[model samples]
Target: MTDKAGIHPKYFEYCYVAFVAFLLLSNIAATKLIEVPTPWTNLVFDGGAILFPLTYILGDVLTEVYGLARARKTIITGFALSILASLTFWLVQLAPPAADWHNQEAFEAVLGFVPRIVAASLGGFVVGQLLNSVVLARMKQRWGEKNMWTRLIGSTLVGEGADSLVFCTIAYYGIITGGTFLNYLIVGWAYKVAVEVVLLPLTYAVIGAIKRAEPAYSPQAWAQREAVRAAR
Candidate 1:
């Protein structure tokens, strides 16, 4: 019964809470459209993309600070939570609007969940996140955990590509033909990856700071070690 990481077990619980919150919020926020003054008017994106990239930052933190297994587990937890949220939202949308509600139409318009979209989202997330975690863990091992930039960006290339392509194709393929789907795919991929690129310095700072604050071979580490072992 040696203490893993020489710290309390509760921190792992806290990390899981943070991970779930970031993920759920990202999904909810993605539905809302907020216009920003980008160079291109047609290339609009939802607010959720802004926050969604932070999950990668979190991914980096999880792998760098706790190692790969814990990070992968967190990703899986996020995947399940995302699916649950989509299913719950779809159920909510199926219920008829009350006559007394003034904003029923508006609510449905914003909060509605389409099954195909949900499936695409869930599928893309699972594949992209799994790829991200695997690449990150292996990169960390190969690179001695020093080059944070290389790992974060490199993993995003694979993860974001999978996410953008799967989501865009599954969600909008037949609906948007020819160049439109391609544009959407490109925009989504670029926007998401750009967010990660911009956040690199901040990610490094946060990961470094968190690693410094954590203890070694405590419950969190043991839990994380177990996760990595399972993934391998």
Candidate 2:
């Protein structure tokens, strides 16, 4: 922990809360596809890509303000929450549908995740999120805790890379052609990184403002306890 230990600012806590919210929403939204036509080719990406990069921004703030251990806990919290969400979806889908319910087919179409894909998502989240927090914490230690863009984008490169490779490989490897799989990997990762790059200014502003406004009451342990509570 930094010398600023024991101080958990109010706005900073809100940031942490927002981080987890974005992460959960992003993962749930990722089940859908969004396609667009570029000048040279048509590109397909998940809607979640737009929001997932915000998690990176939150990771940067946590590492910069609270330190790595806390960020590590936060990452773990996210991973556990994601798994729970997946399981909840699975359970809900498994429960018998009402006789009058007419949206069973549509609901299954939207959320009927295969076991392999679920495993891939959970695994990728653990590896990628940990790497992201670790890398950001290390960079912050070396770089004097400034340069939001460098840390945010740098960590995203590593984190999103792990996430993309694991997700694409395990979830769609045999289902998609090698060429198409590679394309999905590239576009998915690239799109997420681009979100970070584009939000550099906003990230800087948010970090700066929060740092100035929030009191330094560290919630390193409290955050962990809350995460565990949510998981259970």
Candidate 3:
């Protein structure tokens, strides 16, 4: 009978697509390593770092608005899609090249990396996304309708730390050892958390707008409003 959740057709559907898009893109991007400079030093990170943090943010939005059950469903969907994407790439990599096709090596150099990286990402993602969603959902459970930022930031801190550690370890543990390997863990985790913190204002705005426009945000809120109306 009515349109919902701002200009979006269905916020959950939009969020889910965006979540999986970023997830798959980040996995592909992660095949290459990059260095970020600070006045103190240069930090090594994967290309995926640029886009991966947004997944957690989107995860938060899904949890905060639609609740944990649906958020987890979305995470599983993204996870399954990521596996599908990796398998698709692997299949392409295995296919025999045409006699004139000379880019098979290039294809192996690039898309061939997808299976391993995507596998590592999948491991870390399931662990981290679940942690992030559980933390936010639990916080919302306790605080009711207040203190959104606390839960969002807190969850990111927990989720990103675990995700970065698992991913870096799986992706580069034996390949890059000692201080450099450890640096990957710290930098990746800290960078993700920093991105989440820096974007808190925007996060607040998005969540607020969604809550206002989406009627199903909180069953308790809806119940209380209906109770007040009954009194009137």
Point out where model 1 deviates above 4 Å.
1-12, 32-41, 217-232
CA lDDT of each prediction against the hidden true structure: 0.73, 0.74, 0.87
List where candidate 2 sits over 4 angstroms from the true fold: 1-5, 114-118, 146-148, 217-232
Predicted structure with the largest lDDT when compared to the true one: 3
* Model 2 weakest 10-residue run by lDDT: 1-10
Model 2 clash pairs are: 6-218, 7-216, 7-217, 7-218, 8-216, 8-217, 8-218
Error of 3 at 81 (Å): 0.7
Q: Best by TM-score, which number?
A: 3
Instruction: Give the RMSD in angstroms, all C-alphas superposed, for model 3.
Output: 4.1
Full-model lDDT, candidate 1: 0.73
- Give one clash count per candidate, in the order shown: 7, 7, 0
Model 3 agreement with the true structure over 15-89: per-residue lDDT tens digits: 888998999999999999887788987798999998999999999999988878878988999899999999999
Model 2, C-alpha of 223: deviation from truth (Å): 25
Give the per-residue lDDT of model 2 (tens digit) for 128-206.
8788888887887788755757888889899989988887777667866666667778998998788778878887887
Candidates, ranked, lDDT: 3, 2, 1
lDDT of 2: 0.74
The alpha-carbon deviation from the true structure for residue 161 of candidate 3, after best TM-score superposition, in angstroms, is: 0.8
Least accurate stretch of 10 residues (summed lDDT) in model 3? Answer: 1-10
RMSD per model, one decimal: 4.8, 7.1, 4.1
Clashing pairs in 1: 4-217, 4-218, 5-216, 5-217, 5-218, 6-218, 69-228
Candidates sorted on TM-score, descending: 3, 2, 1
